[model samples]
Target: MGFNPKDAIESVKDIATNAVERSADIVESAGYIIKGDVSDGVVGIVSSSMDIATHSVEKIKEIATGRDEDVDEIGG
Candidate 1:
């Protein structure tokens, strides 16, 4: 089959998502190790922030690549 641009874009998205998730995990782990009990609140905030950042990145990528689909959903 010929190269499909959509599939390539999806693959790139998957890679970026994995990288962001891994970074979040590392940050959470470090927070826990450093803050002990207080890390719970900090981790929650960090996780949500990461989710928003990921969603924003995806929207930017979609716009940059000229994908016209509406991105009304956040952290899907």
Candidate 2:
């Protein structure tokens, strides 16, 4: 076997290219996963905020009307 510099350089280039391509694919997949997780988290926060808003409004209404019925209903 002969130590050919040209062949060694070509082989190194090919390996580096393959490694870069594989790394890019992994990074792309991870980006998609992170995006999905952020989307789900935003939806959860929005849903919780809406629920809190509705409950607050209901409580205010009950207090303004001096209603004991709502509290009694919950206790029952």
Winner by lDDT: 1
**Cα lDDT, all candidates:** 0.63, 0.53
Candidate 2 lDDT over 1-76, as tens digits, reads 3345565555456555555655555555556557786665555555545555555555444554445245446546
Model 2, position 13, has a per-residue lDDT of 62
- State the lDDT at 56 in candidate 1: 62
Off by over 4 Å in 2: 1-36, 68-76
Q: Number of the top candidate by TM-score?
A: 2
Clashing pairs in 2: none
What's the TM for model 1? 0.39
- How do the predictions measure up, each by TM-score? 0.39, 0.41
lDDT of 1: 0.63
Kindly report which residue pairs in candidate 1 clash with one another: none
State model 2's lDDT. 0.53
